[model samples]
Target: MSSTKVIYALYNDDDVLMDAVKQTRKAHHHIEEVFTPFPVHGLDKAMGLAPTRLAICAFIYGCIGISVATWMMWNIMINDWPQDIGGKPSFSYLQNMPAFVPVMFEMTVFFAAHLMVITFYMRSRLWPFKKAENPDVRTTDDHFLMEVSVSGDEEAMIAFFKNTGAVEVKVIEKH
Candidate 1:
């Protein structure tokens, strides 16, 4: 199998990493990926990544959850077996909506949270028993790694990363 050569720039501080990312973009370098010990605020923006649409998916999931809960409660309390509890009759779902509010809210939150997590994992290509794709162990500890696809002048790319406050730079063949 043919392998692609890429540059990996390691930084010690998140701030420095952020600046390096900005400079790399300014110089028109295409960043492949970035690995960090923790989430870096605005890193995605620096890397020119588009905003995530997970919130929209969460809203849709929440709507589905509430709809399911409403249908289930209506079927159980109103359609299947009508009940007279606390001197209240289950004649109309609208009239009994206040009583079902708790269930609706719980279902909405549950579905939104759970489905959003699943969607995020699926979108990220994360799966059970997946092998780790991290390039360096230090990225999981206290370092940040920036991966850039090399196009021309490997030596100049190394010099550019070093000027951007990278602690170390290496070129490796990525499969």
Candidate 2:
């Protein structure tokens, strides 16, 4: 099941791509992915990358979408079909919480933007119309890719991507 393979390195300079991810993780070499359009500072702690809870699961799915939109507007306009308008009252959240604050801020930004985009596409295995495993198409147009997935010494990972300053290297399979 180790078929999805790639080995690419094309660097210009973000300090030589952060010293080639700290020398290919100190020559242990297991970097699976890295692509750069921006963000290259420290590169997720040199690709250890274990500090994402997805903003605490989008703040607990935005507090369960503001407690199910304030309990479905307190069970439909304060207990089913209640319409007391200007007189207020009818589950008057302290005499009108600014008209339920734009439906609880659009249900907490629609449950924290659709449950933080389905918890970042199920913590980034992605799904549904998933046709991208881009080892390189010049890594989305400018090239800063540094993907590696070697098994053993494939010529010591092609001489550690040309001694950690790879301007271009390629080994591809996982199409």
lDDT at residue 55 of model 1 (Cα atoms): 89
Candidate 1 structure quality by residue, lDDT tens digits, 67-156: 999999999999999999998878899999999999999999999999999999999999999999999999999999999999899999
The residue ranges of model 1 lying beyond 4 angstroms of the native Cα positions read: none
lDDT of the structure predicted as candidate 1:
0.96
Tell me the TM-score of each prediction against the true structure. Answer: 0.98, 0.35
> For residues 1-175, could you state the per-residue lDDT of candidate 2 as single tens digits?
5566568888877788888888888877888878876777778988788877788888888889988888888778877877889888876555666788789879988999997987788878899999987656765666688888867867778787888888888787774
Best lDDT among the predictions, by candidate number: 1
Q: List the residue pairs that clash in candidate 1.
A: none
Single out the weakest 10-residue window by summed lDDT for candidate 2: 134-143
Candidate that scores best on TM-score:
1
lDDT for each candidate structure? 0.96, 0.81
